[model samples]
Each structure stands twice: as structure tokens, then as C-alpha cells.
Target: MNDMKELRILADACFSAQVGQALKRFNASHPEIQAVVSIAGAKDCLQQLKTGDVYDLAILADSGVAAAMMPDHTDGYYVFAGNSMVLAYAPGKILNAKNWREKLSDPKVSISHLEPNAHSVGYAALMACMLADSVAPGMSCTLLNHPGRKVVAADAEVTDYAFAYRTECIAKKISYASLPDTMDLSNPAFNAHYSTAKHDLTGDGKNIVQASAISHAVTIPLAAKEPEAARDFIEIFLEHNFTAQGFQPRSEIVGKSPRRIHAALEVRKPPRVQSANYEDEADVHLLQRARLLHRQQPAAEAG
Candidate 1:
């Protein structure tokens, strides 16, 4: 554990840059630990974890998908952070509508979302639309298909609107419409309501992904070459502030509890930020409960 090591990570594309930045800082502080991050679609990351021993850790935004894919790959995963879905439009667009739902219902307006089959954010956007339709009829608008968030952001000027993460809009300086709590898949408190909306991953009506609050999960694979380094990186990651980056800390959702106490350390100055054990039994249970609607293959088929 003392020897210099390299910790490889596969991360969800939507927030991969932020993760890479966090790990880069970790590497700067600890020269002995070299962090390598590779970005890919959430499903691709899981598929790689399933097939090879290349990555020490995998971080994905969709906890349900990760849990469904991580049966025998690792011990378990920790929910580290969460993000909200937002409607990003070009800067000069005039908005006289009451809310995002109203603006979306217009057939004249064109929109874009990541290809539903290739990315979790795409499916999330689809589910968001379905939920919006249920509450307010006639939210039926055609969505332009894009391969990734960057493409969607790039085409935002030409396309009337695009569904993207709040973080993406903030980082790219695109104007976005903040959704209501009922429609924004950000708060864990609205998990039940969100579950009512779902998207079929496979066109055959099987393998469906239900709408749930967006929370990111990180896990150290059993095949990790540097498990200790991966754990250290995760510890540093959770303590770092991502609020400016548009991520809501897991501590605010379910990580903090009265029964938990800060580690006993004799020092005049307290730690800059108290770290939360994201793998705590109660916190894991709560996260699992929130993701009741998930796509899981049968054991016989999964193997």
C-alpha cells in the first residue's frame, strides 16, 4: 500500500471532466498516487467493468443502472453526489411562457437530447418528458437526437432547446430553465412521484429504466489493482466542494445523521470539511429504496 500506484477510473461522460479535475488535484497533493481517468457513456463504463480488469473504480450518474450491473463485480458502491435535469436553450430566445412545461408543449419548438439508447441522460430526458405529459397534457414535442451532451450544447444555438444537466448549462454558459421540484429529477423526496415515469431501453418493451432522482455512485471493483488508492481518491472526492460545479452533495441528502459522530482526533483546528462515509449501512439502504424502479436482467440471463 505504501508503494507508488496508479488508480484507473472509468466515469460517466456527463460529469467526467469534473471527476478528472478532482483526481488531478488528488494526484498533485500525493505524488505517490497517480490517478488516470477515462470517460465514457454510463452503460459503456459498466460493460467494461463487466468484461475486463482494467479500471480500479467506475463512477456513474445512474445508481440504479450501476447497481443492476454490479452484482458480482464489487463489494458495493457509494452514492457520492446528485444532479438535476434542466432545459437549456440559446441565450437570445424569448421566454414568455409560464414554465418549462408550457414552453415544451409547443410543436413549433425544436429540441435535442442525447440518443436515448446510448446515454443515461438521454433516457432521463425521455422520462422527464413522460412525467411532464402526465401532469400537463400536450407536452408532445419531437426531440432532436444527439450523440452526447457536448453535441447538444454545441448545437444549442440552432436548436430551439435541449435537455441537459444543470451543471452542463452552468459550465457552458447556456441559458437554462430550472424545472419545478415535481418535474426536476433532483430531490430524493420526490422519488416516488418520479418512479411513475419510465422509459423502455429496448424497443421490445423489455429492459425499462424508470425515472428516479439523479444520484452518482462510485465503486471499487474486486479486480482493482490499487484498491487502497481508489478508496483514498474517493475520500478526497467526497470532501471537495462541487456546489459551484452544480452537484448537490450526498451529505445534504442522506449522508448526515444524528447518530454519526466525527472521528476523534486531537487537533486545535478541525478538518476543513468533515468527510462522510457514503458506504454507511443506513445510507446505502436509503439509496437502494429510492431506486426501486430499475432494469435488472434475470440471474440466468445475466450470467
Candidate 2:
């Protein structure tokens, strides 16, 4: 037991389960390293870090990493992957096509969303609703009052629909409507348009601006108990796990004084494969569903 190296990680719920499974596979190859991973909302993860709890590594949304960096809590930060927002619903509970927006606005339709002030997904959901309202005028107010609930809980509680990650819906095998670039927070081209939409969490008129894309960021905290092991784990993750799990790996680095590491941050683009690549089969299916749902629908449709 003395020879084992313990590495602790705190990450947002979207990435935690998959990452924990990946770490289990990693441990199989390196028997000397033991990794413990905890997944929660971005705010909860950040709160744990701020309260003096030591974690070797942290995987959070861009905003959470920025919060940690402000106080010099992290040694460096790296952009690892990206995700987009979607509206998930039980199969057949909600229609997939043209009437989706109308369905959400219906008083009888039970809608749920994460807490906007606590999770990145929640913030993105709020932004998506705001964007929808831009074209429809009242859509934002309807969604803002959606009962706050975790995605999993909402699913079990029979929520008609909820805002969620495109990848997450696919991962959970749920039917979802793929949101458009303007409302999904996936396209950087819509950054200015997205910036125009904001929501006040405190209900006191202070607006919290949302980013256009959901980029996953990682960092090694200065208070880490085993920094080198944490760094090694990140290298393994980047080299072997991310792409396989359907995330678009970022090539560029973003952070304040990022620590130099042996791992190459940039993943080389692979040659395009023509055949049915199982690695991205789920992603392709989700996109196709999104297209089918949005085809011929008005721009004001809920995503």
C-alpha cells in the first residue's frame, strides 16, 4: 500500500463518470497509481477547492477554472474538450419536430433545468432560453421558471424535457433535440449574438453573461498532494481517452502561466476515415437526430 500513489480529482458531473471509468482503465495498466474521482456541479467542485480540500487535479468548465486562477490556486490550465447544449426528453414524451418550441411553452409540459447559479449546464440552458426568446419574445421567461432539478433526477421524475449536453444525452441514451449554433452555445461564430443574452441569478438585476461554447478545462491545483501523478494522469487522458469518448479535443492552450509538461498538448488531426467509425457513431447519430428535429422548424424553436 505504501508503494501506491494516490491521485485525487474533482470534476463536473458531465465528465466525472466517464473520466472515473477511464481512470479505472488507466489503473489497470499502471498498478502503482490509485485515482479517486468525484463528480459534482461546477460550483460544488469549485467550492470544495476553495474550502482547502486537496485534489491533485480538477476538471471543470472554463468559468470554474477562471475562478480558481484568480486566487492563484491552480498552477496551470488546459483546454481539453468541447460540448454543446441540447434539449432532452423521454422517448415519445415530446415531439422531435417543428412543434418542440411550442411543446416547451405549453403549461402542461413539465420542464426542468439545473440550477443556473451552480452549474455550467444550467447557465448554458438559461442562455439557450434567452436566445429562443429573442425570436419568440416570451420563451426565456417560461424556461427561467422551470423547476430547478438535476438532469438525472429530472429524468427519473418524468420531466417532459430539460436542457442538457448533446454528448450527455447521447451518453445516457436519451432522445434529444440538437440545438442550433445560435442557441446551443457550440458555435464560436455566434459569440457576439450569444453575449447579448444574459440572466440574473440573484434576481436582483445583476446579469451573468454566458460563454458561446462549453469547453472543458483542466488544472493542477497548487495544493495538490501528488502533483506529478496528477500531471501524468492528464497526459494519459489526453493521449488515450478524450477522442475515443466523442469529445472534440482542443489544439490550442489557454491559461495563466501554464506549467510546462512532457505531454504534447496538441493532438494531431487524423486522416479522415470514410467507413462507419464506431468512435464517432453516437455523435453522428445525435447530429442526425438534431437535424431531423430542426429541419423546416422556425429559428425560434427551443433547443
Best by lDDT: 2
- List per-prediction Cα lDDT, in the order shown: 0.64, 0.65
lDDT of 2 by residue, 172-250 (tens): 6677765556567765655766777765544565334445566777788888888777777776666555555545556
Task: Name the candidate that leads on TM-score.
Answer: 2
Reference-based lDDT, residue 122, model 1: 79
RMSD per model, one decimal: 10.9, 7.3
Error of 1 at 229 (Å): 0.3
TM for every model, in the order presented, reads: 0.72, 0.74
Error of 2 at 206 (Å): 11
After superposition, candidate 1 runs with Cα above 4 Å error: 1-5, 96-99, 140-157, 202-207, 252-303
What's the true lDDT of residue 170 in model 1?
A: 69
Model 2 scores worst on lDDT over the 10 consecutive residues at 271-280
